[model samples]
Target: MTRLLVVDDSALMRRLLGELFTHAGGFEIAFARDGLDALRQLHEFQPDVVTLDVHMPKLDGLRCLDRIMVERPCPVVMVSAMTAEGAEATLEALSLGAVDFIAKPGGAISLKMDLFGPTLVEKVQAAARARLPKARRLAERLRLHRAEPRPRLRPPPMRPAPAAPVGLPDLPPLPALPGEIEGAVVVGCSTGGPPALDALLAPLPADFPWPILVAQHMPASFTGPLARRLDKLCALTVREVTHPVPLAPGHVYIARGEADLIVGRRPAGLMALPAPAQAEHRWHPSTDRLVTSAMEPVGARRLVGILMTGMGNDGAAAMTVLRQAGGRTIAEAEETAVVWGMPGELVRNGGAEFVVPLDGIAACLLDLVPAR
Candidate 1:
């Protein structure tokens, strides 16, 4: 049976969570009033998973998380309020070593209780079953102690070679078609995509002409936070998209967990499409489904496909179909990618016509989009 430890300062929250987990069964449950109490319980209960609250009395969640990582090392799911400060703290907790987090519902004790009751149980169950790798655990521990200071080292001296301006082979310019390209921009990314995405979207002018659809492999709970975080950093509007919303240009849509993002045409206009049933893919927000379904309404002429860094060839097959349909394709160059697997496959298989580093992707995209 799974063993769980629920830690929170609020007595009501503890009671509600305890009741929820108890009803969900197949496990043992322990309750702690605060982070310190939780740490005390850890010594006795040795829980399989821990549900931690960020703003607890005595010891804060991040400190508790540090102790747990160094001492017992159980999977921890942070419970945080939905406020911006709470979100920031929760992310810090994740960076500190917590596996994941669930935002507490509005301020009401009862509503919050009802909201988190089910999700809390589910996260605990999932956490209990997860087997963290030793290397990952060690890395997390090191990350906690290390101050992420910027590198100060200068580049090594190099022999002077060329005197002339360096000129790379220019990629074939995008064609000027008879009609306007009329559909969404679908992007598939994983692994090293976070920083890459920021770099790519930062340079996009405010009036970018198409709705951007993205399938980024991430946990469900992290998607919303990730979207919000990206929204702050990006020039375009970014949000976690739901099913049945129409596609609109100048906005960016990020696929939510377990949701397949598609594009469809309705009587009114073009809109975002979501599949009702869950599909099989190694990653949630599967790039294969996103890229393939995006081709439906947009067809070849209206699509722009980009495959970014990832471990598998999920988007390669879909990119081929898009390529055959005359959709534009861009793949990240191997040198700039964190894991070259996904984009590498596209390059090797002749799916991508253009290959560029992460830094230049935004400029390349701007060049592709026709002037409005």
Candidate 2:
């Protein structure tokens, strides 16, 4: 059983979280009433995972997160309210080495908290698999951890698999541009996606010529901050999609968490965010819808599908469809993936034209479809 530490100032929250893990199965729960208590429990309980509340007495989540990452780096899942401040702190926590976060539903915590059970368990299990390295020096850890957590996601330096399985896409030679719009790349990722995206996208030059679309599993509050964070690190312009806007080359469109971000064929190609889906889709920013929607307007010949690390097979089949239609597609190799579920599924179904590690994904993308 995985040992878990539940830290929150509210006794009810503490008990509720404990029960959540209990119902999820395969976890040993330890409780901490506050951040100070959490620090004490850290040594005594030695949990494999932690679910820390953002607001706590004595030692708040931010300070405690800093200490935990610099002192003894481990996987942490922050539990926070679904508010602006909570979202900001949660994103900061992720940069500080917390593996993921959970948003509290509005109002009082009731049986609604139980609705979070499965997601909590999945994130905890993922964290256990992808523990951060012992951060080494405090200053070094802080500097590296904040700037780019994705590089840490890379396994200890090893020879990248020979370039055979990764190269120019197998599609037929392309025709001239349609005049109205240039080609585009649609990306799907979850779990440890932000860091992976950072690693994959930051290296591209500012003049990168293709429009990029990212459909990562996240909530409304989290996605905007993530885009802003990546924009600071990347040369390419990154913006969150709130209203429908035509995608421009050399820019990045991050899918809104509240809706399924899809491309539509207007007089010129365009971007549209429909109503948020409550059923028929497991994730809010559904990659399945994104890829399928691009088939006609974007065309398989001019599109690139990239399925990265995530829990489910959300984009696998649609990625295969792109391949069948003569478009290029790639998956993050298992060795570099945090969970390998999405990418693994893509490889299993033979959906990917290339299976590249985290470090090589950008190169592979460049090779598959040269920038316009």
Candidate 3:
């Protein structure tokens, strides 16, 4: 059985989570009433995964998560409230190595929490399978998080079109395309996406002249908080895009986790057209639809489409579309991706022009955009 430790301060929430996962079967559940209790349980139970609540008496989720990463190093999923503070804590937890998040409505635990049983189960299972960071890599990533203003650049490259890492597949060589590099950038990612987003986004400078749009698989409650978190770290401005706001250069617009962020031109300027979620998309805030929508709206100008770490081929085909339209394309290299599905499929299907490591993607992106 996959051993799981569900940690929250509320007894009712603990019971609700326990009942749901127990009924869901497949899991051997253990519970903790608060952060201090959760740490004790972590040592005794040594669960394969942990579902952590953001706030708690005595220890709190952030401190507990830090210790777990240092001592045990298992996948931890954060259970957070939909409010801004909860969102901020959740983002911090992800940076600290938590695999994913579950956003609950804030204020007292209620029966309403049970509605997320299926999602909770699904995420926990994913967490169990996710790769945990080693002590050294974890240190390195955190060091970068605290690094100087200049974005970290990848070490010098040997093979321009490099050989794949030992265990990963040998990708086909991409044929070179047009040399001119003036255009917007669109990114689509999911699954083990947050850390990868940080790897790529945090390094770019504030005056990164082109407009960028990202459609990350997330919920309505989480996107704004994520944008706020990233904006604080990134040199470039980040905003949680809502409604028909006009798009501008040098800023980033993160699509609502639940709504698709579409792009088009208006008499005034380029604009964001976030539409209602469509049932057919499977993943809310579909990256494919967003890219396809932009093809018409952005006109003849070329664009850069990036397919990062994710579970499915959500952005693969659309990335191909962007590449065909005189745009450049990149995928997170197999070695660095937590789940290689999206970027892997993109490379196999010949959609990616560059397959760079996670830390290297920011450099590649800046390379594609010339100073205005």
User: Candidate 3: what lDDT?
Assistant: 0.77
Clashing pairs in 3: 206-235
lDDT of 3 by residue, 164-240 (tens): 22233433322223432235788988876777777778778776666789999988888987887777667778898
Error of 2 at 177 (Å): 4.2
By TM-score, rank the candidates, best first: 2, 3, 1
> CA lDDT of each candidate?
0.70, 0.77, 0.77
Superposition TM-score, candidate 2 onto the true structure: 0.87
Candidate 3 deviant stretches above 4 angstroms: 106-114, 134-152, 156-182, 299-301
Per-candidate clashes, comma-separated: 4, 0, 1
- Report lDDT (Cα) of residue 183, candidate 1: 57
Tell me how far the alpha carbon of residue 139 in candidate 3 is from the true structure, in angstroms, after superposition: 8.4
Which tens-of-lDDT digit does each residue in 1-372 have in candidate 1? Answer: 888888999888888777787788887888998878888899999998899999988899888887888778887888888766786677567555565567787767686666557766765665565433122356534533352221222222212112211232323434544444465577888654554565566567666777898887654566677677667655678888765776666688888755667777788767776664364666657777878777776676567778887667878888867776677778877766756778878777677757877666676676666756
Error of 3 at 209 (Å): 3.0
Show model 2 residue runs off by greater than 4 Å: 131-169, 172-180, 272-275
lDDT of 2 by residue, 1-372 (tens): 999999899888888877778887899999998888888888899988888999987999988888777555668889988988898788777656677788888877766765777778888888888735233356634544565422223232322223323344446435436344567899999887887787778777676667889998888888898888788767788998888788876688899886788888677556654446557878868888898988888788889889988888889888888877778788888877867889888888777777887777887766655544
